[model samples]
Target: MVDQAELELFRDNVRRFLEEEAQPHYEQWEKDGIVPKSFYRKMGENGLLCVDQPEEYGGIGAPFEFSVVVLEEAARMGFMALASNLSVHSDIAAPYILHLGSEEQKQFYLPRMASGECIGAIGMTEPGAGSDLQGIRSRADADGQGGYVVNGGKTFITNGQNAGVVVAAIKTDPAAGAKGTTLFLLDTDQDGFSRGRNLEKIGQHAADTSELFFKDMKVGADKVLGRLGGGFGHLIDELPRERLVLAAMAVAHARGALERTVAYVQERKAFGQSIASFQNTRFTLARLKSDIEVHQAYVNECSGKYQRGEMDVPTAAMIKYATTELEGRVVDQCLQLFGGYGYMSEYPISRDFVDARIQRIYGGTSEIMLEVIARSVLGR
Candidate 1:
């Protein structure tokens, strides 16, 4: 267990860093379609990226809670783009390399990743496939020279524009179904790898989501992550933690939304009184606040299970599915209270409303999560 005071200090430090660095430039970054790479470097300098990684690889190896705090703090401040992008870099991508990569892969990647000298990404979603891993069509064929040539495309990839390293999933044997899947470590500097435009989104605009292509990209067999034909299992194995990370963010972000809405209602006037004095406004605030606090406890419990290695896929999915859906409702209701101003892009509630949307769709859709949960209860 981490010392409580030290964790509070860490949270304070993270908030100070984001206020000074990210908060000021976030609007410009949103307009630019991406956050600058220098900001990532600064995050690294402050030991804000991958806090759970080990010291030998440039991390403080702080407890998992520390990483959760970093993400939650960012989300609580309404910097969804920063929170979303950093979640990919620190929570999703870095862990794949840490847990599955070869010694050489770790040495070459984790240090730079920890230092924000290199950014990491995962390539999984294809044009045709969103939630189903078995539907992936990108492929890698053995070259008979102790290597393979990869050819495929990935869309909606987070951190795509600035990725120094990508953990790409491709089919080694398409006929074999999920059993044939393989994961390759793709170094973006390689000749055949190309990046498409930074795709625009409804929100989280500072995140550099993009479409990536690989054409005859040859890599040594050594680039294989975990083992040949292990991609699906590897992806599944990681989902619990991945979903947990998103769930945590959802809870924190919703809290932020509620915070904004409460302040807005208290100050904004209605029929000769503050909007918050209205019974309808009071009830809505009460309900949302109650829901968020209850959900926070649930998320905290799930996170503890994860830290103890006791969390299962279904339980993780439950938290993710529940909290993200709650986030959607919370933000939308909060926006409703803002009246026409909620529709404007200028208000933080508007951002919260839009940003809350993708939480359900990504990290496995609510439907997919339900199916996973169903399998546990109904027998697959």
Candidate 2:
């Protein structure tokens, strides 16, 4: 459960932080293609980095709702790229350590991560694999020194360039398929670990997305995450929460675009009249608002389920697919309301539109989400 008053207070703080610290510099970062690593440390100082980990690790250890508030505020401010980076560190990577890491691993990394001194990245997708985790070609064979020598590369890795540590997925036995998959936490400064240049994209320029290569990178056996051959299971266990937050982000993004469009339509004139006075404009925005409200409620329900530990794979897939698809549609419709200005890079809607595109691709593709949903309905 969440305290409504506290949540609102936190939302105010997050919004103020962004307006003062982030928004003014966001466009510049977009041009730079990466947020400064020092900015992350600043976020730690503000206690805005990771809000939900245990206090011993320098986190507030607040309820998951506090994190939800952070996510919503980020998206509301149109800071999607930065929000995604923080979520990856706080929600995605840290949980693996909290749940599966040895005491030494937890002690060494969690505090640094919580303080934003060490950014975290997860390596699961390879050149040949995206949704199909079982198809990854990265390999890790045992070294007689009680460690594994990792070989192969990961592409489209979020936070790759800036991450101090990475939880890499590798195949311990290629012939064993998904059962052969293993995860190892490696310090990126280690010998033979390299990062490729930041990949250019249509959007999300501020977020560091890159290709990571491991050339016989050595990781001690103690660095293995979870049980041997249980990497797939660990990933599966975490997918629902990941997908759920993505859904929430989608809804928040759409709401941001829609709100901006609402204000734009009222002020922008067309054919000697305000566009808001036109029937078509009213109907378009009305439909979009209605759709957003309905979807927002569903996402809230899903979030509640997640906090209760009742979120399931199929439901998570459904929300991910539905909300992301809805985000695309809502943003497109909202952008259309801006007419030519929407197409201009100067307009915030343009960024929102492009950023929404990747929501469907990562986390899980729309097609993959459908497959997961269909399996639940048709019996897998």
Candidate with maximal lDDT? 1
Compared with the true structure, what per-residue lDDT tens digits does model 1 show for residues 7-103?
Answer: 8999999989889998889899999989899999999998999899999888899988899998999898898888888999999899998999888
**What is the per-residue lDDT of model 2 for residues 118-164, given as tens digits with 9 covering 90 to 100?**
99988888878998887899998989888899999999988988999
Residue pairs clashing in model 1 are none
For candidate 1, the per-residue lDDT at 55 reads 92
lDDT of 1: 0.92
- Cα lDDT listed for each candidate: 0.92, 0.88
In candidate 2, the residue pairs with backbone N, CA or C atoms under 3 Å apart (3 or more residues apart, or in different chains) clash, namely none
Q: Each prediction's Cα RMSD?
A: 0.9, 1.0
